[model samples]
Target chain A: MDNFDKIAVIGGGSWATAIVKMLCENNSTIGWYMRSIYAVEHIKRNKHNPNYLSSAELHPEQLDLSNDINEIVGKYDVLIFAVPSAFLNSELEKLNESLENKVIFSAIKGIVPETGLIVGEHFHQLYNISYENIGVIAGPCHAEEVAMERLSYLTIACQDEKKAKALSKKIKGRYIKTKVSDDIFGTEYSAMLKNIYAIAAGIAHGLGYGDNFQSVLMSNAIREMKRYIKKVHRMKRNINNSAYLGDLLVTGYSVFSRNRMFGNMIGKGYTVKSAMLEMNMVAEGYYATKSAYKINQENGAKTPIIDAVYEVLYEKKEAKDVFEKLTNMLD
Target chain B: MDNFDKIAVIGGGSWATAIVKMLCENNSTIGWYMRSIYAVEHIKRNKHNPNYLSSAELHPEQLDLSNDINEIVGKYDVLIFAVPSAFLNSELEKLNESLENKVIFSAIKGIVPETGLIVGEHFHQLYNISYENIGVIAGPCHAEEVAMERLSYLTIACQDEKKAKALSKKIKGRYIKTKVSDDIFGTEYSAMLKNIYAIAAGIAHGLGYGDNFQSVLMSNAIREMKRYIKKVHRMKRNINNSAYLGDLLVTGYSVFSRNRMFGNMIGKGYTVKSAMLEMNMVAEGYYATKSAYKINQENGAKTPIIDAVYEVLYEKKEAKDVFEKLTNMLD
Candidate 1:
């Protein structure tokens, strides 16, 4: 608790609420921040998140709540950012406090739009945060499951081995299991890429492809992921690790994945804008497809799944035609 | 088509019938054997299988139907065994002719119970057949989907490269795509191993594990598979190949997979005997698990999935308790 005592979670989504719930199991007190003063007041009075994970109660005495980003950033030694990447830039814009020494953990699973880099890379280049101080929280674990207290596993990745193990202990509990790893680049990229694959899975499902096809699609997708990440980072780690393959499987197969949901709507013949309007939350894969497509153009990895999703979501190509072509490309 | 002209399918199940159906599309004449005299008559009279994939029509003129194993084996240059592995030995016992010169292709996905060998191995060891003459048909393709004429892919694996390619062309059609591989050992073992994993997937689903857990289970299952296969038969094969990973995914996730269905029942509190009584056919994984569990005792691969499933199915351990322990073993 000595090292973990001053941790804070940013953003007000379901994942942020879930992260707070996990941290509270080990540490008695921590900080939380949200932009909405009204939501802050609502949680303080009601003892639960008003919008997400409402069943997970928070102790008012344990939580240091604030509307100003700088107030929480100034106080906490460790910052866990859980905001959607699309909005991450604006949140960091309000941070007057320097994060050079503070350890930062990212729970966000997208590339920052302006930089087209993962949250950790964005912070390292833009905020002058060292990679050694950057950490990532990855999962096959879903927030709804954590709220239900079902068994879940999390991978805490950092360039600093000691920091990773220390953070892993703070998050592990009765239903939550944690593993520590030093491959932060692989974990973060896998997290980002899985969302795109999930969108691919959802699109296939929406187009009425059975579970048989879904499984084959996933098999090919993981292989493609191995190829893509190898070209980008070229690490010695197994992609089958929970941080990579397990995370990909969950996002691709789980009903909780919003990227899959967005892809499903597109496969069902909704235009991208209509699908986004229907779902109030942002789907990171929609933004990720563009960034990944641009990145792959330079790197030149053979990614049929990503290309199909990009064609459907960005180029306004027919989902049926793209997926039909995709089926031939796979297996 | 000319080389595959003397080909015969040596089983009466849905998969055997599907094979015969695919072969007939390319060859002008093919042989089929069903041990059931009743099923043979039913097919001849009704133009389809009486018990399995009943919708797939067969022309009596195109098929050389027989019940005697010796007649089929003696006349056919290539013998494709599609019978359930549990009954394969007794069926083979009826054959008086040797398989020394015949090309043996195994579509069966279980170890011969008495011999404790796969169908190809059983033929190679007992009938003095060569590995060069042994072949395996691997699939993410389900027979029911084939009956529905859905597009599907198959991998024909043989030690002899030319034989593998020749068989691939015979099976390739408008609805089916075929790829040839020379890794006969890797493909056959993976084909057998996938059924066991499918049962594990089913058991988890039956015990109320969600897709997140299933994906994790499957991801771990694949790695475990890679580990186990490497121990028994070291090779340069990618487990992600359609023959390995694709086949495993379909069996583990597909609704049509009897192995998964058998596992689901076990997880849903049915005893082994009760689950077997409820289902009419053999679940190959039930037998594969026992054989694999025995083999791994010497191989010493750390297979928590196989061990947990064996405990639940054979050792009579409680599914809930076994799976709870399995959660700790996974990530």
Candidate 2:
């Protein structure tokens, strides 16, 4: 706590608010940076983020809230970014202050849209941050469940096992459990790939596929995920770990996943533009599908599920037909 | 179709009816053995099983329905057994016809209660049937879904790959897809173990755990399953195959699973006797938990979920307290 006490959280999403809620159990003061001053003002006045997880109360005395990214960056040594990957670059663009010395953790379970690199790699290559300084937070946890105070587990991954363990200590609480890992890349990639699979799950459900097919799809999916991640980053990590398989299962099966909801609409015959307009949230997998489809073209894992999802979501193929082909490919 | 064409299906349950439905597509005549002449007469008249899968239409012209087990066994060269494992020994006791020359397939997903051996092993060791003659039918396929004709996958596992492929051909049809594997032991154990896990999944859900915990539980369950099966069988089977993981997923998540429903009732504070009394069907996991718990005690695999379920259902531990302890053991 002595060296890593000054922790700052970025983004104004439900997940970010949930993280702040968890950190507040141990940290007396947390630096919070949000681009929207209106959301910040609402939280300051209401003692909760009015937009997300409104039930989670906050003590203003424990928060160092600011709109300025550089101001927050200059103030904290440990910075946790929780923004959507699509908006990550824009937020970092506002940071004129150097991240060379700050210990960075990504609670963002995605690749940066601008660079098609995971948050850790993006920070290392573009911001010149050391690999040891970057860490990841992977969860089978949902922000809504965390707001409800349901028990959830998280895996903290970093090249520096000490940094991962140090941050994991602050996040463990009555309702939260944590594990530490050195396989940062594996955890991060698994987090990203799961969103794509969840979309496939939603599409299958909307297409009237039953639990029997869904399970086969999931079982095949974990294998596909293992193949893809291992191809990209060869590590001695178990794909069955909660960080990989658990995240995939929760996201794919949860009713709360926006990616699945988006895919459900697509399966229900909503076009790409209409589905996006209907839901006020980003699906993440929509962009991820394109990036991963392209990425896997090089890695060349036998990714039938990802290909089927890409064909349906992006290539304007019929969901029914695509999935019909997928069924034959699955078992 | 050479020597295995005269097929007999033994059992009158939904799954048996489903397998019959699949076989009827290829076999113009199938030897059907049921203990109840009433149900046979009912199917003959109604063109569907009166007790289960009542929606699945049957062609009595294609079925050689019989009340006597030996009569059907004597006529068929290949036998598919779908009886509940608890009733298996008694059913086999009625068979005077030798099964030594017949290629036997087990659709039973529980162990033989008397000998505590899986159906395949019991036939191999006790009945003088060669391991080469014993096969397993595993599924992420549910009969309810099969009745609805939704696409489902089945895995046929046998020591002889040729027999597995031959049976897979009979089972594969317009709606059903099949995979063949030489993993009779792995598939059989996986089929038995998944029921126990499904009950655990149900108990967790009934105890108010959310999707987050469910996924973590599933991820952990699969790893535990791999450990347990690998220890007992010591086979080179991929735990991610449709036969193992897919079957577990469907059983755990499907609303049609009686095991999950039974566990749900128990978790909701019903006494085991009361829960059993309420359901008309057999929840196979209830018996499976006891068998698997004892099996693992000797195998020495770390089976926390199986142990927790056994304590809650068999030892009468409170679901809440048991699950609280289970949460700490997971992830």
Q: What is the TM-score of chain B alone in each candidate?
A: 0.96, 0.97
For candidate 2, give the DockQ: 0.84
Per-residue error at B77 for model 1, in Å? Answer: 1.4
For every prediction, compared with the true complex, DockQ reads: 0.55, 0.84
Cα error of candidate 1 at position B44, Å: 3.0
- Top candidate, metric TM-score: 2
Candidate 2, B253-293: lDDT as tens digits: 77668898988888888888999899976688888888899
Which docking class does model 2 fall in? high
**Backbone clash tally for model 2?**
0
Q: What value of lDDT does candidate 1 attain over all alpha carbons?
A: 0.87
Give model 2's share of reference contacts: 0.85
Docking class of 1: medium
Residues B1-331 of candidate 1: C-alpha lDDT, one tens digit per residue: 1266689999999899999999988999889988988998888888999999999988878888988888888899998999988999899888888776788899988899998887788888888888889999988788887887777888999988889988998999977878788887778788888888888888888988876677688888889999999988897988887788888877877766889999999989998999999997678888888989998999999999999989988899998999999999998
Clashing pairs in 2: none
Model 1, position A281, has a per-residue lDDT of 65
> How far off is each candidate at the interface, as Cα RMSD in Å?
1.7, 0.8
Q: If chain B of candidate 2 is superposed on the true chain B, what is its TM-score?
A: 0.97
Model 1 scores a TM of 0.95
